[model samples]
Target: MSHTSTMISEDIEAYLKEHEQKDLLRFITCGSVDDGKSTLIGRLLHDSKMIYEDQLAAITQASKTSGTTGDAVDLALLVDGLQSEREQGITIDVAYRFFSTDKRKFIIADTPGHEQYTRNMATGASTASLAVLLIDARYGVQTQTRRHSFIADLLGIQHLVVAINKMDLVDYSQERYDEIVAEYQVIADKLGARDIRFVPLSALKGDNVVNRSEAMDWYEGPAMLELLETVEITHDQNRRDLRLPVQYVNRPNLDFRGYCGTLAAGVMSPGQRVRALPSGKVSTVARLVTWDGDLEVAYPGQAITVTLEDEIDISRGDWLVAEDDEVPLANGFEADIVWMHETALEPDKLYDLKLATRDVAGKVKAIDYQVDVNTLEQRHADHLDLNAIARCQLELTAPVPVDDYRTSPGTGSFIIIDRLTNITVGAGMIHRPLDSELPYEFREHDSKANVVWNRASVTQAMREHLKGHSGKCVWFTGLSGSGKSSLANALEVELNRRGYHTMLLDGDNIRHGLCKDLGMGEADRAENIRRVGEVARLFAEAGIIVITAFISPFRADRDAARELFNDGDFIEVHVDTPLDICEQRDPKGLYHKAREGKIRDFTGINSPYEVPKAAEVTVNTEFMNQQEVINLLLKAL
Candidate 1:
């Protein structure tokens, strides 16, 4: 070969090598207390020539003063950045280290092994693709080792490198390595961690970590660094479904309008069809805007601004998704949580749930069960103490779009914050949303607690006998612009003239004061009905005829309202007004606002109105006159 050609070949080889090393891996080191997690990381950094000369000198000097590693350098000092950690000779928090080799770049988290800091380890492991579980060859597998392994399994870590460290303590015997591996295999089988690789090395002596171990020649496997560099993680993410949550609306000028957020999943290209969640508005992607100028395409994890071809109602927390999938849209969810607080989680106490970019109020409805890390047993737990992992049902005050955690964790996981204190209490993984069964239990008990039959002169039956009629809660439910409020007020006027004490609770009038803060979103609207349902129940107990007008969207919420009343006392009055008639009438001009996109979650427009399954009286305002509807309600009463 020519001399000039040889130089050019070398340059191409260097570029290829650099490109190969750009693949990044994120892994975590976790085990029992004093398992040398920090030491193993320190040895990797030191052997890879990553440690500076001055930094090495400081660690070498600290080793002489506080020789945790005996005559050698205290490598743990390299990762133990906290003063408390150095003083206690233990890792108390999750410490992250960034390093690179000729083959790959790596980000390793050194997690604490102490039981008290187990939650911290989970936080670090939550985002890791692989786990380096350390097992002491001398002690075999300990309890904290099982704890770490169980947590890694729960967090969905698919790859595990079981490093049998401190092999020098056992004279580097292959027999001891085999025995420890056999013990861990049983636990690994239980965790269903099939992709487990075993390696025996001494982090203190720097054996089989970055270099082949001369002490154990019988066993041959790639060193820890090689496995980390070669492990396939590019395909681990959910790349099929597109989820771009709008974090901010980027408007640099009148000419430019873009939605800014990191793509949580899948890919997006210009002109691709996309749908906005909750609003369900479909539009074509106009541009993939970035700081580097407009791009033709964008993939998951890339932060970019997206522009749509048509203008629509979109705000922060709304998701832009591929227009070809059915995802759950709701305000409540059943979730698995890891409690990280000192105080126990209460069932009914309201909490601030922060799911991705959205913040809303919710409450833990119930603790189904807690898992035992040692045995992997599901034990009954009334309340979750610190570091307790359990499945709990949560009820949010508004509807949210949450994908299943197994499918899309980025949009499924959330943090529970104390409403008043604003401190994060726990981390939650959404299993699914509670569209019906759950949350009913929450409202059922809440309304029941406020009422109790007591001895009194003015008894319910006595008041009914004197008034010559039983109290009734006539629930007027239908779509907005369906003349529900007008019909309810007219019926109330007729009931009063018939010598029956009556009152009407209009939906709009109630929103002005009682439900003013509630949004028109599905969840908020359900909550509005719940609040009004309770007040209507109070009026019914006074032997006075009570009537309510609301678009109460869900059958489950309406059922919960009825659960608070006695049988036959609560009357469901369905206003059977067709959508076309209501839209034409548009008494309050709501349908016009809905068509203009000025009103969101307007029933029969954007949000749905689940018609009553069984109503005591059904009246059609378009086909019948006002007196005919009033006569039907009176006959039913």
Candidate 2:
């Protein structure tokens, strides 16, 4: 038997004997282009006797055709399989390889080393438990080295191994390796890469990779292979909050219904009380099932279908989480994205933000900052190009529950898909959810596909032109009995008499039908205004002047409604009336009930009213009568 084959046989035999005790370790190798990343992985596979006989022969033959190292068998050919990759002698895609040792099994992601392929590297690092960052011994610590380390730190990979490669070019000198390690330590510390280990080895000669080489007798640390076989990774996942994003609903026939998804974190049992989000329905798990059998308990990374005790509604993209989880409900966020597309990201252009299994309307609200690749400092940028890393404020038209990536990775990482071409344009990690008083618009887009996104035919301008007047929404805001609904009704009657199309959306009339399901709370009030704004926009689109008379007390909520319309289309008319006059003229007796403590969240009573500071039209109801106010509004419109 060949010497390499003998070693393979021994390792396989040992692994078989200790298979029950072994654990899997996932790691990625990354650094600057031409820094021997692929070669080092190939050398590790070769020296550890992991490759098959025919595979070794194919690489040996491929070396003769186009190899970086002359005469000797090119090991990099084993991992760099693409035509463009082998032609340029660089890795353009993430190549994953599986191999085993007696102590542990490993999944190694051979990521791209070029600066332009930073997105490709991020894809590999997203799930890595450890990062084997390579640095060229000849060049010392370079830009790519710092970038990989920074990204690894950003992705929350705690364990880092800095492999200073090509030591043979520098005569395997301990001093040169130490110099590079010292330089890297400064940057790693700045980036908060705490658990770091450094090693020096020559990949071409297969020294200090699998076997401890006598050439580096000055080095007494473990070999790279030994470190992989022993590093613990059982506790890498967040195990506190049990998260299972419903991926599929497994239903076979009339008798069966199950909610199926992979357990993203924590353990699951048959009787645990789980709450499904976006709906917030609570239920108990009836059965913890799998294809093999019914499991008594399931851990993270296990795929299982859970049957709820109650017939609660659960669907795809709904999160079945622990009832007491600290996950934040987010409609907008400011995240760091690695722009992967070639075209520069345009400002305010809508993209589909796909998180886990859900896709929502998203756009780059603002470019907060970008990283200077060399200086490692945050710099202001307006747009991002290919492989550009920047922190952008992502504005979503809808909200979802989020856990910070540092705490829970499965719920925090996402990608932006181009709505036109359906291509993945960027990858992002949510740093925190935006907590402004008014959140982003979470509405879905209604554009048809296969061309530039437009509403197709019957444009808003055409509708307005046919009506002989510009369609608009005159939104009246004030406390109850403050002449808001009366003014809106009179305005609607006046517009109708003047041969203009009009519709009146009164607060009580809307709550009876369109908003029948909503309750009287702060969130419900915001949603009420949002729905009213949507209806007003649709009415105006049909060439009708919409008059919404809701006591939208919060200025923030009113501002969010304004964003739903074109400029000048939303005319905020504040019906200025004092609290005492509003109390004296209680039309619905709501003020009397509020004063008697029978009503909760009644505007101008328990719920505070934030009067408009810069409303377009201000009508002092204390002085101006109904006729004067109607005439004033007609002239303004």
Candidate 3:
């Protein structure tokens, strides 16, 4: 085997030994475009002589394809490997690279710089102990520069390095470097960055990146490499609270069973008592074992299988926490979110939330505010679009174990998933549970004396016969201005005239009252339909046929609402109007307004409108009038 391959194998053995000794540190590099982040890391690895001969040959060969410059090898290409990313000459995803010096080994997460990739940067900085924010000397501190710094601070990265790169462009001038340093100092103060270090260097020219720059005689600071080698990162971790979220329950053999997961925070030893959260079951640690052998104790950064003294019904998604430390439990929480999906976040829609290893169904209950990343100020917004950072309130179907992100990074973060597409839409940091202070109390109330208020015990058959028809909900759905409201209104009138007690629920009318507080985002729209469906069910229970007119676009959301109703009770009537016909009609002048961009998030304009796959009745508004569409809906009913 080659020397480098042999060294890598030896390093793996040493890594296992060091892990058993419980010593590891993780850091992330975050900055904007042309910040020299990739080069700085490349310099660190190169100066340490960690690059293999084959890798060096590849980089040299790749460098020949482009024009020869002072530092021709595009070091950024070493980490960014995607075809599109290479073509655009930009980093798009979080690329992780591992390297080590004599002093300390490091796992570095190199994040992208584009504003659109802010979510990727968050994923990199989520579990990092320190963050390196690179700044170009010419631009000083741009909006993305400030935004990235703020995000690092929000993620609890206490240690920060503001590497002033591209000093060659600025003539290695201390005055220019000092001016940029002053600009970033204001941001550091606002963000509460405790340990801030400013270093001036040119990554391309190999000055002060790996070794001290001879050109920068006026600058008096340790080189970037020297600082990283000696920097103390151990104190940055949360060692006070012992939190180990159980990822999987290992029951491989019938004779043995244990909890298997990485130690997220703090330390635990054999014979130490640990409590299982939610259940409050306490057990003593019997043994901590890895693949190699048993360990007397295990700390954070060590992945081990833990065995308890007694058998317990412990499973995945449960937290194994220190007995003395407080554990978070709440059904409702408020969080700051960085939306990453094209679909806007809607208040009132249920989303699948994934936190750590636990998954829970949650709904966006309220939108507190959105943060303008440039100004770092909260602004009022009805809905959050892609790349928007907003503070929102969420109500989980069941209580989840969580923590304040400022206190514990691991348990305090979550991701929002789209129920239909199963796509991760946003990343969230839990600020606090809605009811953090109130102590949890469970009590049973006494039953009141039995009483029957209603005089008549109404049967379903008798109620249907009295109404002269069966009670059901006629769900009219189509694109906006597709005659859904007109058809539903006409149908309600006809049903009432036919002696069937009928109620018309227009989407716009319900938005004025029942869903008045909600917005028009994807999540909010789904919630609006959900609430309307429930109200229609109540009307149906009262033996009244309910006609609901809504632009219930997404099939998944419509299906979810339909699932709540009994079979044959919910009838979907699709108004199949072409986009061109709806735009031509423009009955409410909505299409004209959409064309003029008077309002944002108008369906079929700025947002997507999903067509229903199956419907009980499909009425083409082009081929028929409102009366004819109503008749078709009535026939299905």
TM-scores, each model vs. reference: 0.66, 0.66, 0.65
The 0-to-1 C-alpha lDDT of every candidate, in the order given, reads 0.85, 0.86, 0.81
What's the C-alpha lDDT at position 230 in model 1? 86
Task: For model 2, give the RMSD to the true fold.
Answer: 16.5
**Model 2: what TM-score?**
0.66
**lDDT (10s digit) by residue, model 2, range 1-637:** 1122343466887645566456888999999888899999899888878888999899889888879899998999989999899999999999999887656778899998778788889989988999999988999888888888888888889899989899999998999988998898788777655578888888889888998878899999999998887777777777888899898998899778898888888888988998988888899988988888999999888899999889988888889998777667777877888888998887699999888777789898777778876566876576899888888777788878876777778888899989999999998988888753343343466546433333323457656666778878999999888999888988888888889998899999999999999988999999899889988989988878899999999999999889988899999999989999999999889999998999999888899999898999999798999999998998888
- Worst-scoring 10-residue span by lDDT in model 1: 436-445
Give one digit per residue, the lDDT tens place, for model 1 in 1-637.
1012343466888765565548788899999878889999999998887888898899998888665978878999999978788888889888998887766778899999988887899899988989999999999999988899988987878899999999999999999999999999889887845489999999988899988889999888888877787888878778899999899998889887899998988889998999998789999999998877988888788899999999888999899999986777886788889999999898889998888787889988777678886667876666888988998878888888878876777888899999778899999889987773332222233443565434442457646655678888999988877778889989888888888998789888999999999998777878998899889988887888899998887888899899879999999988889999989988789899999999988878888888888988888888999988988888888
Clash count of each predicted structure: 2, 4, 1
TM-score, cand. 1: 0.66
Q: Which stretches of candidate 1 lie over 4 Å from their true place?
A: 1-21, 192-194, 436-637
